[model samples]
Target: MSGDAAGGLESHDYDVVVIGAGGSGLRAAIAAHEAGARVAVVCKSLLGKAHTVMAEGGIAAAMGNRWKEDNWEVHFRDTMRGGKMLNHWRMAQLHAQEAPDRVLELETWGALFDRTEDGLISQRDFGGHKYARLAHVGDRTGLEMIRTLQQRTVALGIDVFMECTVTDLLKDTGAAEDRVAGAFAYWRESGRFVVFRAPSIVLATGGIGKSFKVTSNSWEYTGDGHALALRAGASLLNMEFVQFHPTGMVWPPSVKGLLVTESVRGDGGILKNADGKRFMFDYIPEFFKAETADSVEEADRWYDDKINNRRPPELLPRDEVARAINSEIKAGRGSPHGGIFLDIASRRSPEFIKRRLPSMYHQFKELADVDITAEPMEIGPTCHYVMGGVEVDPDTEQSGVTGLYAVGECSGGMHGSNRLGGNSLSDLLVFGRRAGEAAAAYAEGTARSRPTVAEADVAVAQERALAPFSGGEKASENPYTIQSELQQTMNDLVGIIRTAAELEESLVEIEAYQERARHLIVEGHRQYNPGWHLALDLANMLLVSECIAKAALARQESRGGHTRDDFPGPDPTWGAKNLVLSLDATGTGVNLKEQPLPVMPDELKEYFA
Candidate 1:
């Protein structure tokens, strides 16, 4: 661990510091600690409250508890096909091969998954999988996963710094130049600065969904890790591809963007228009045509006998489903709330609906005053996940920057253009362990002594952190206003569908928000100040928003989550390339370059053939 003694700020040292404390962070911390390294987890909120808790669907793994035919090869094919063949071959392959072990590992750690009649862990059907592959605990799979991991971490005696937000990654300036030395952070409760000095830092900070107006993400999903990585000299890949989950609650002003889990569809719910027409059948894309049912009878029958019939069109990958929903609303067949109707009430029995989707039932009954077991849900597309983040090694999860590793939602390449439903939890477990093991190994192998902290760098960070209060009595710009405007801009222009003109316009609007963010003002003292925290988060959102817009503009062809109205279709040349984003030398402008996709190994190539 690097030693720090600058600016009189509070400091702690550790062999590894894992940021975000979500499923990935906790899992990574466990692996690192087990690998014989002292580890600490830093989080913006209390432990177990990270966005992973909101994940309702189960973890995807070819466990074969429900379907004996399922295996890693089938899982790999589903992943690559669902991603539109744009996923990093190695990451997808590794995720498929290792996911079953990770899920079984969780079971050993005390996760109480729902079981089949024979008493094996229950597996459920989700979009894009060829078999019933998701191991779940009712609809609260994430809750169970987090609870189990949290218990293991406590049992292992790993340290945790709760409600701490890391603002910057500090690097060694002298002989160990460009390598991460530590991180500068602040306590959310007391608003006092704290520095975590560590030899290795793993980012599991999640996505950038909050950058849009309607989203299924929480405030913490402001792209802090993505921005931090760029500032620390790491590149971001495929920034243009942002997933809009097809089933966000579209009614009730307060719950406009709350997620309606895809498990609703997986469990026999169907998408219908206001005229009572099943709409997904008419909207199947050419890519998914071979697997999706063309008729309503076949679609319904597949739920009971998946092997004898094609899968329902409603079970298409998220990108295609979201686009279908968008097109339905645009074609004047929308629900009362400008969305489509998701009818589980008409398809499944009330007892089965309540038993299978208890959370969805309660979430709707309590929040929206609608019982999902009896009524159809008003649903639409809402920004949910980013299929892009810090570009990292497929094997190690390490970024280009030395001593910096990323996993889970903050790291890219696992899901190429769009993620399949139920895949995220497995992703956290698989790559999170790899990141931890690799980071520990890197730290153990380094011979460099503790690096010194420059007083100037500390001073600059302190100054910037407190800048929101600098205007004092004459403070003008409201941080919330800028944040809201930025969200509106992204939602309006760079949303599920995009055009070259709107993307260009979005860049201009983002530039204006960036200017306002610079002058953001916050009232009151630092202690427990939400306004001040949002002010700091604004910087990250702007940087991430810029990357999204610029990358969207650069990629003209429509593919997956990034749809282009002007281009209209995926181009073969564009399909072979990835858009990589980084900070220029000045750190004021974004640099975007196209790179060719990695070739799949011959051993893995047989599965596709």
Candidate 2:
């Protein structure tokens, strides 16, 4: 809280400025530093608590020891199928191949994963994986991952700015092309602004989970990276594909939708109706016929992998499982509550269940007043992750904004419409490192491509800094209301199994909320106002939702996360297409374009089988 609260009138320069010090952020900083660049990792939260710490599922990779026949091809096929064939092939290919090495690298950097009999890292079964592909550190896999990267990064002595929010991207006004110079940010502690100008800026700010009332995300995930990139004029892809975790705590609506881990399912939890009937067998598709187990005996046998039995199909893609559960509830076969029951109690020994799923048990007992070991938890889909984000090249992870790069959930089109469960952790690790390496490579010979602190840029940053104070003392319409409304609209209208009418209605509703948000107010000083933080987040949610809804409206086919009722079948014409979005004056938003998919080489095409 030192002296100047004059907003962003003051300016600083660096070799690289990274927003969001999560797992991806830490990895990016390390890569940049190793590549000989002065680096800074800025964050809105205390070092280790970024949303990556909250991720409970394991990371996906083909360690291949458990199943010798396994390779990147099977992993790729599973990803495309899990995403309902909406996944980008090149990204999925790179993600699958690089994941094993990244996980091993983390182990070298001090991540202690659960071990097998031979003392190597162990793998486990998760939904949508053909083989046991996910390597984990108990249920707190993401936590172990972030902490490992954090410690390794500290050893390198990289610069870090905590509790600073990036308000705008500092674009190079010099006669340079589409490249960016760096960025400007708001320091929350002192309520001042700091301009960090660098040749490269990497955005790993997670997702817009904070915009929704019910989310698995924490307070720090405000979509800042997406908003900053959008305003800076980089096109986004697949905005319509927002994923809702199939299981979130239901009763005691006050606490809202906290996530129930997928690991519970991996540990033999059975999804049943109130009458004690298992319904997933009815939903298995013919496409998955070869691998999917049909009967309960066959399903159980899949666990042991008897000399000749088929694997369980109940572990089908997340989108498929979520839909199956939704159908159960709709057919009046649900529990006393609206959700289908997930019972791990009867399937496995109580001791094994407790040891493997300690956090799930603890989280439910502490937060929801229920023990999963004894009772089946109530759950329904809530907006969880977005598959689409700032469009970036496969190798570089750089968006159209030359100096700006994206990684993690903020950058989209990676998962297409539906992401497989463990791939997200791997996506962060693999692509995050690539982005860092590429950005650092670009930053090596590049000097300050723009003015360090030109007068005009400082003026705009200063105005941004004083925005909360500028509104009259009694600013109305709480920002949280806008946030809640956003979640409600998206959940009710744009959720799983949507319609043209619903999408159009949601678009109009989002617009109305956007107008209402204009009249929204921020109270008190900006020092630590959660309210002001929420207000800024509302703008991002509004704009991002508009693109999602518009893309949903335009796509006319049911594929991946974007399901339209009028068009119930997947249209072949739309199979290889992508929807691109950006912000401009008219509010009509950016138009759709048919971006080409990577031609799968003959060698790679064999993986599709």
Q: Could you say which candidate leads in lDDT?
A: 1
Find the number of clashing residue pairs for candidate 1: 0
Q: Evaluate residue 544 in candidate 2 and report its C-alpha lDDT on the 0 to 100 scale.
A: 76
Report the lDDT tens digits of candidate 1 across residue range 1-609.
001222357999888999988999999999999999989999998998989988888999998998898999999999998888899999999999999999999999999999999999999989988888999988999999999999999999999999999999988877445788889999888777898888799999999999999999998999999999999999999999999999999889899999998889889999999999988888888877888888998887887777553789889999998999999899899998888999999999999999999999999998889988888999999999999999999999999998999999999988999899989999999999999999888888764676555667776777778888775455689999999999999999999889999999999999988877776677777777898899999999999999999999999898888999999998999989899999999999999999999988888888877
Clashes of each: 0, 2
Q: What range of 10 consecutive residues in model 1 has the weakest lDDT sum?
A: 1-10
Query: Can you write out model 2's per-residue Cα lDDT over 202-232, one digit (the tens) per residue?
Result: 9999987765667778887777788788888
lDDT value, residue 557 of candidate 1: 93
TM-score of 2: 0.95
